[model samples]
Target: MDIEKTFALLNETEPLKISTSREITVAVMGAGSRGNEYPEYGKLFPGTLRVVAVSDILKSRREAMAEKWSIPADRVFGDYREMLEAGRGGKLADILLIALPDDLHYEPAMEAMRQGYDILLEKPMAQSEKECRDLARRQRETGVMVAVGHVLRYSPYFRALKKAIDSGLVGELVNIQHQEPVMYAHMAHSFVRGNWHDGKATTPMIVAKSCHDLDILKWLAGRRCVRVSAEGGIALFRADKAPAGAPERCTDGCPHEKDCPYSAIDIYERKRWFLYVFDLKRDCPAEEILERLRTTDYGRCAYRMDNDQPDHIVVTLLFEGGVTASFSLDAFTPWGGRRTRVMGTEGYIEGDGKTFTLHRFRTGEAREWSYAPPEGGNYRDSGHAGGDLALIRDFLRAVDTRDFSLLSSSIEASVESHVMGFACERSRLSGTKEDV
Candidate 1:
């Protein structure tokens, strides 16, 4: 594929062409937050995409999605397998949106493709290298398109950064420094006391959380990552780090609750949005929140939890054509968002997700760019700073046109980033550089 042509197409103004009059039917395999978010793109472009079926284990989620989409009771299923099997009788949707958990991705993705459905898969592709490869191979064999949820590539901030680099303002790309500062409260909620605390049970931190960063680095480099070396460990949020007199459950009169930043009540009770991670309905009563916290894993003290993934990690990658990059993930940060510095032979650029600065060597001056979301808008309201919306739009167009180039994050290119992530994890554990 021509790099310039692809970028030109990406920046084109022509509206994406879908069916002129008919709606593109969609089926959702998971009715969680991400699942709900993607189908919402249909509301933006009516008569183009419609969610027609939903399957989820949670009755409230499934019922809510079914009601929202006006899906019939027969089409609402508790099991994704049953949903897919039901679709075999000539009801298979044009696209299957798989927003299931990390471990649940591969099987449904394979099944969906086998049933002749295109996919909009959430990121990491799969939990392991072999699974990633299998999804890639299956896509090839079935001639089905997949748009992995590497939404950063579709974000305006990243797109502008890419355009600046490609304009020769930075010359040939050389090195990239990127960091993802997972905020303290978020780390405690999602990684510590939440579902992804164990690397062995779910996925390594690099693959689970920072795969987006790895994918972004690889995309900007415009080359394959050939090797990686990494070093990190569980620095905090460990059982041994628990304060004296702290109980397993934060509500059980833990003395440190007043001072501990990771106190469950302080974090969960203070923010209504945090309850979404537990699959609780929005605006749940305080009693319900307390009861869930009293029983569920989400209420556990961070330091006393059974978490194992590192609170901080650093990875160095070597890309094809001698391009190199360094990435870091820190969970103890006060603020959250990605920071990046891209250095080339002639100039350099730095950005903090919302704003960026570009400096040219000859001019000896720097230019700044700031991202301002639309009026009455919050950047965080849309996942990944509106990248999620852009990704779904592109995916819908790709599915309609059967053109892989329309997709910013195709499975073919995305699998390489997953491979790099796996290599980094191997290096982190073995203490030796590994080839991707």
Candidate 2:
């Protein structure tokens, strides 16, 4: 699709009038901590992209954010369906941002697309590969302005690294090793043991969280993946790891609160939990957390919950033209972030998550580039490191102008990643290399 034409449509209709000199009156579909708190995206785009409305399933969550961000109470709704209905009727949103749970992406997106509104969809596109294909097909048929939030394409650090590789600083690509330490705490908090507990409830971990890696690997390889081999299991954070004398539930009377590393109270209710929550605007009340624990599945003791996703997975990919890449997702890492190493015939590049070290045979030397993202980096992490702002800017510009070049991940590229991931997951289950 031509990005410029889409941008032109957005600009011509909306015109970005900058009504308040600081905010745009946008109705954010679901912008709680996950999507709305994106730090890399400047709260408002210097007079565009404002949050005039917010919607979420949890009334208190939405209301709390609305109150914090100063969104009018009447503008906030508990139902995303209502928001979409109103948007379709021309009373809802100027632009719709779908930041809801992975499984909830389809309905809102289809609704917004049907309504002819510009949209920014959080990645993986949808819960299933078929859903992703459907959305892509819809995008092609409708020609509505939309951009998937594949932030790596917009991240300056990754972009610069891609540039270094493409510039022949690291000659003819040979092999790559990318390790995304899913982080034990993070996985327990978001996947195996928390809100997104199961594949049916949330999404397959490969797609739910590692789609970005899939997309970026495709982007970096510049070739479609041909085969995938994967192996993983729910190796950690299971019932077998329960501490001695630990109770079945956090609410039940038991010891180990002081020593257990994975204790529910220590991880979810303490001040340290905010580190994972990534909320700087409001401190989560301990009383509120305990109340939720007492009532919700999220509060169940980590060891006893009926969780069934892998805590670790390793996937290998063979790209067309004989390029080989391997990715390992270690969900038990004590520290977080990603580590990558790409080896080529003439050189090699290694990145310890934030910094890049490039070695060239021609120069017989190595150079490193460090990009330290701004503080409170966790909550606002976007566009790779801080790349989303640029990505959003580019997408809006393309939509306003009809230039397809502005898009880093076109529909075709995005699908390649999704297909590759699907194949990898299939291979993981089948115990054999599968065609991508």
Candidate 3:
């Protein structure tokens, strides 16, 4: 329950000795942004981890990953099941890094564990509660470790916040208020006209976007969520909100191209990095980018697209021991980051993901802490404010030592958070409180 102590145990483990040079072999199940991001851990910890095989439906992506890692041609497969089959003979990989979609997580994860490999799964473990429980049961039955990607748990800002709370800087945590501002541009690209547009087709907004917040709430409270109530709906980004005379596709002669904030051409052209979402060729000419946008979902008008995710949502949680928390996710913000306020018996702490301020009742003064990446460090480049790199490092260590306790986001511990997310969705639908 003391998250700081849990992180300390993970960090204090002995480094690999010169004489005991063993590298964990990893097989990637999806070679998208997240898949590519995790393998970069090998670059940070030289010779400690190797990606041996990769599986993706996209030939270009899988082949590119195989080439990047120097994996044998035979080891690359279009199907994850084939990759798992190859690993069953103990010849391919020692671990499975699953960065597949929300609905695709359960199958690959279950198969990988059944094939005798530990797993590093992306969050929202599965689409439904039954799937989550099944994955947990599989891990327990097989005695294989499974680490979920709750990257915020490894972030420096949150870790410091947790430490301060545990050290009684805040006498006792009584309530929390947290907000996730999903920037407007990002919301359009990812939720409005992108792959995760529909809640019924894939997942609810809470489960797909804010599971990390749910996990953090549970972690900070250090108690199980007992009840949840939520209220939200798709307030914007629908057909009714489409501009008059606007075409279904942004590139299809929409009159508001120059003025529309959610114009696909403007958004995608300005931030070319977002092309990764289309899974298309990157760094292409402007004509090519425009052509692709004209024909794909990525180019669709944000309001006209078949998106069901809410533009705003708020959830209230009741934790064990009478603690309470409230969380909000809004897509209309100018910035993208989380802000949190923790109220305690003696004081309260406030954070904006990059810095924190602690106010004490006794001193009538505030203490501040800010995060600065180390000199020549790639924290920002590594993504998630350095949490991604830290997570992979801890996961690699846990795999190397075969120590489940070394991970803070193990499958068993993470499923509860996913449950909270599902419960929030249910509450939103039923218009009543739901038990977690």
Model 2 bad stretches (over 4 Å): 1-25, 38-45, 64-75, 275-291, 372-384
Clashes of each: 0, 15, 0
Per-residue lDDT of model 2, residues 267-357, tens digit only: 7777346433433223656776766567766556777778877778899999999999999888888887678898988788898666787
Residue range 1-436, candidate 3, lDDT tens digits: 3434533432231222221148888889989989999788786666878898899989989988988889988989997778777776773677789998777889888887887888899987999989999999999999988999999988777877777777777789999999999999999988988768888777899999999999999998989999999999888898887889999888889999999988889887766748776665567678878887878888988988878899999999999999999999999998988999999998898999977888888877687766555443546434786678778878887887888888999998888999999999999989989999
- Could you tell me the C-alpha RMSD of candidate 2 in Å? 6.8
Score every model by TM-score: 0.93, 0.85, 0.93
Candidate 1's residue-wise lDDT over 364-434, tens digit each? 86877655454433333467866887788788877777788988799988999899889999999999999
Q: Tell me the TM-score of model 3.
A: 0.93
Cα-lDDT of candidate 1: 0.84
Worst 10 residues of 3 by lDDT: 11-20
Worst 10 residues of 1 by lDDT: 9-18
Cα-based lDDT for every prediction: 0.84, 0.70, 0.84
